[model samples]
Target: MSLYTFAKNLVAVILFPVFRIKIIGKENIPKEGPVIICSNHTSNFDPPVVGITSPRDIYFMAKGELFEKRFLGKLLLKIHAFPVKRGMKDRNALRRGLEILEEGYTLGLFPEGTRSKTGELGRPLAGAGFFALRSKATIVPCAIIGPYQPGKRLKVVYGKPMDMEKLRNSKASAQEAADAIMEEIKFLKENHSP
Candidate 1:
């Protein structure tokens, strides 16, 4: 198996038992073509949870600090994680994201830009919306619920692919697309039961 697959499977083996992950709406993931998996950030565990549950491989833009450690950086890179300097507009990272989509790969993004301290949805960064508009990729909003308590169920709900055509034609701002995506995620989180 590729390192990405091995790592994803390894993570699933380690976390699934402890977290009892429950996935809903996985079918919403497109079988082929470019896709953008947008979700809220709560814990560091969110990425792995979403990655393992997703049907396709996911490329993520992690914080640049994560790559500061040599070993961890290489390992993360091997497993499809790239570094991005957070809190500012990093053009390289944005370009890389668009490239991934152009190549028809899945790009995973936490629209909030960072983890929420109170486990509440935060305003989405314009990056997510930019990717959707620029690449015109299928955007899927995901909501992850429940804490990382051992033996406690962690639920991940994937919403339907958003229709961006209207927004694209309306000459909507990236922030507007980001807001709409967040609204869908909020809906899933509030309505989907654990």
Candidate 2:
């Protein structure tokens, strides 16, 4: 394993139980190959919460500002994260995501684009769907449910992968596909509310 993987795993082992994280449906993840993990954004902690609970290394797209700090940016890179512009189409980020998939790695995306301040599910952005369509990768819908309080236990639910082939061939637009994915996440969130 890469040093980054080891470091992340160590941190997860150390903190997840302390945070009372409860992960479900880990077996739903494919054992290998490129997979897209599309999840809801409830808090700033959601990324690490999902990432640490996952069985494999998951690369995520952060905003460009996160990477502007040299030290923190270097650390993020080591942890397999790259940056995308917040309000604009970031071609570079798109390319990096495709490259990660092409390299047979898992990629995590919050289709809602940003964290939900009120902890309500937001309309999903089309980036995740577009990536799935372009890369022909399987999309695993995930939901993280809980308040971000230190002592509260969090729940993570993983849904079955969406049928990308059907999505690709159907009349559904990219945004439609993204919405469908978000709907699945919403269902899981409500059902598995912590």
Provide the overall lDDT of each model, using Cα atoms, as 2-decimal numbers: 0.94, 0.86
Over the stretch 37-120, how does candidate 1's per-residue lDDT look in tens digits?
999899999999999999999999999998999999999999999999988999999999999999999999999999999998
CA lDDT of 93 in candidate 2? Answer: 94
Per-prediction TM-score = 0.97, 0.93
Q: Tens-digit lDDT track for model 2 on 1-194?
A: 98677877887886677778888888888989999999989788777877887887899998899899999999889888899998998999999999999999999999999888888888999998788788867789998877666677878889888887877888667798888898889888888874
Model 2: runs farther than 4 Å from truth? none
- On TM-score, the candidate that comes out on top is 1
Instruction: Please give the clash total of every predicted structure, in order.
Output: 0, 0
RMSD (CA, Å), each prediction: 0.9, 1.5
Which run of 10 residues does model 2 get worst, by summed lDDT? 145-154
